[model samples]
Target chain A: MIHFFNDIARTRLTRWVFGWLFLVLLYQWSANLMISQLESPVLLRVDLDLTYWLVHLTGIGEFFRSSYFAAFSFDFFLTVLCLVAVLFPKRTIVPILTGLFFLIYCVLLNSYQCWHYHNLITLILLIVPFCFRSLKTFSILFAGLRYAVAYIYASAAIWKLVRGSVFNEGQMKWLIQHNYVDRLAVEGYELNFLENMMFQLSNYSTLSSIALIIGVAMEASFLIAFFTRKFDRHLIIIGVVFHLITAVLVDVSFLQLWILFLVFLPPDRITSSPTTWFQRQKA
Target chain B: MNFFLRDVWKQSKIVFAFFVAFILGTIWCTFSKIEITPFFLWAHYSDKQTPTGKFERIYIKVNGEILDLPKFSRATREMIQLPTEYFVQLERTDYNTNTRQLIQKKFASMMSQKSLQKMEGHLCNSKEDKNAYLYWMAKYIERVTGKRVLTLEVGTCELLFKPDGTVARENFIFVAKFSRA
Candidate 1:
């Protein structure tokens, strides 16, 4: 079984996935900056970043304590440099910088509790470029990434299933009626186009219930990716559509998870299929 | 050719063994409440699972002006941390040591008992564990909005709904009060 798994993990497509993921990280960082302006004197002492213990032990806590702007600058600069360094994978510094950059970014994000989970998929995807060296390492990293993504989806599905609220028609209707409608009312804003749509969806309980069920089912279907490559591309498409719809309706975008889903694309088909088509056209 | 094949086989076996162990460990940790670094096994949104069925309409009054909870909640969600169970957890950890040291060293004079008490009610923790978070959160609001938050009051309205989607009852819960001198 181990030998069989090794064969399954071998791929020439890993590098492309690496490139795609790096691009997504840049977008994630940019979106975060746009949403939450990390201004100068952006005080860091308040929140529990989990990096405090390590910083204290190393006697370098002072550097992070004050000069909030400096911390943000260093994090952003290192992230940019790491993205550039990724293209030069042969250099030893590339991997080192990748690891260092990821650590800094994690610490910076952990300062805010809500933002901690935003880029989790990106962090997991980074293991490939940061950890693997020779071709032999590819199998291990691919296996790890595959399992990590699968586990995230599976765990979410299991959680929803156990909760039972996801299956109950009340969950979506409740969210729409209570959180959004009440929130809009308190904010003194009339229900605009999207909000009105959500309200209408809530009015038709059956539609919202069906939407919620499909969403949960789509998440649950990710388990198939772990066991077999079949339907992987189709699942990625479903995931993308699902995220796009949610982004429109709820203003919640899971772009990071969407990019990570690109890993499920069959690498050989992606890289070679175009060229194969061209050759067939000529013949 | 033979030597090359043998080396590949050996490497593959080693890598595959490690992968197997990791997969098994992640599966095990999913069911158990264990915190491990670099390998987070669970992605359970606990809040979603156990539905409270109450829409939290929280309002805060800083100084003499009233701050709307919905707008406050939105802004806080984007910029400042919202007062969720997650925020409380963050408070518990940061207040363990660094916050007190920070207050004593630099922010001692700025501290106010009224504000501290008010912030305490928002967090689900002990008095000692509460001070650092409350003080910092108060200071954070001041810095971010450039508003002098003299006194703070948090009021929560638990809005329930009937099965047919009509409003059931709005129960107002006054949670906290803080004053900074």
Candidate 2:
């Protein structure tokens, strides 16, 4: 474990992961999706998740929801912790606290939104390995994280197959019409390039069914990762393309989940050169 | 893989235990059709959907002006849509009384009456709850649009999907309306 931690390659990977996460935090804040910008939202719905029920029943969640100052302070503290974790990549405690606070933020946000959005799940899982200082531990957790991502996609495909949705010819056409009814109903509501393409594709049953099969096939492709690492880069590309297609067609942005792609980065490819004092010491 | 697992077991028993638990929990959740956070059912878009010909869409009008929700950002759109959908669901379920009764009949053996009551209390959705949500939504719309909302009207518009790839809006039914004094 010590030998693995002392290696410069692992240090570069650690810095890169935290650096990417810090950027995601900044983007979320600017988009008004951060906890501080929520302005003491009123909780409307809670999921069946026991943790969610406990937080609300214990009044801990209500305390944060009713007080803007407390929520803002919490967000500020979390941001500081993330920044510290990024600056000092070797510090285990900071990432651990960051992960805990971010998990709370995700649960509260979902409760307030009255819906379960799975986009941030990837970010939450990616933060786990950073909480451990040992590279051996990191590798184990990172490998597990990779499999988790693969399972998410592979399982989604399996569900579709098991439920026989993939065989339904009208499934994608109906989904497109249902999801975009508002846009389609509005007169002269301009559709973007991708939206226009999807709408056009939905016009023909054969075309729409083909698109649906292609999507399921792409998801099923992740099953290969569990068997071999040779196609990791290819899997990374497929993941990005899948998300892009979902974002444009369904209007669900899984951009935050893209952080999990960092898991595919081989340690040697993480950095071209080690320029930091920590790397120098390791060398 | 064997070497990695051996190393994980030797280096950190806690992480190894967590991995075992996670794997087992994921399988259980998959089969039992329940989500326990961290372990989730990724069955999104898996349901077989058929063409209903007509679909009901929630429409929001602020200060007598129709609000185009698709024009807003994703976060803003969700903020406006999800709670309104929840409100509509509550109305359809008769303020959750029907749903509560259904659950009571279905899971009476698994859950105690006191536990069932506790669940019902957490999900209490009376008319007052609807009003509170409407009030909050009105303010949220004002904040997002930067326009003071004198009146907020929440309604459902039935959209008819034509076979020729065109959609027409049909009956607009008022579900709820809130006015600020």
lDDT of 2 by residue, B65-130 (tens): 778887777876887888787778777767755435655676678989897777655544466666
Question: Which residue pairs overlap in candidate 1's backbone?
Answer: B114-B179, B115-B179
In terms of TM-score, the best-performing candidate is 2
Over B4-66, each residue of candidate 1 has an lDDT whose tens digit, in order, gives 234435667765566567656656655564433444544533235223556655545578565
Mind giving the per-residue lDDT tens digits that candidate 2 earns over A149-220?
Answer: 888899999999999998897898888877788887777776778778887776788988888898899999
List candidate 1 segments past 4 Å from native: A1-63, A67-70, A114-118, A177-182, A248-251, A269-283, B1-11, B41-53, B62-79, B83-135, B138-155, B159-181
- What DockQ, between 0 and 1, does each candidate earn? 0.15, 0.48
Candidate 1's fnat?
0.12
Task: In angstroms, give how far residue B40 of model 2 lies from its true place.
Answer: 1.5
lDDT of 1 by residue, A170-275 (tens): 6776656645644543434566687677667866778887987877787788888656767877877877887777665555556655656655766554445577
Cα lDDT computed for each candidate against the true fold: 0.53, 0.76
Least well predicted 10-residue stretch by lDDT in candidate 1 chain B? B118-127
Prediction RMSDs, each to the true structure: 8.4, 4.3
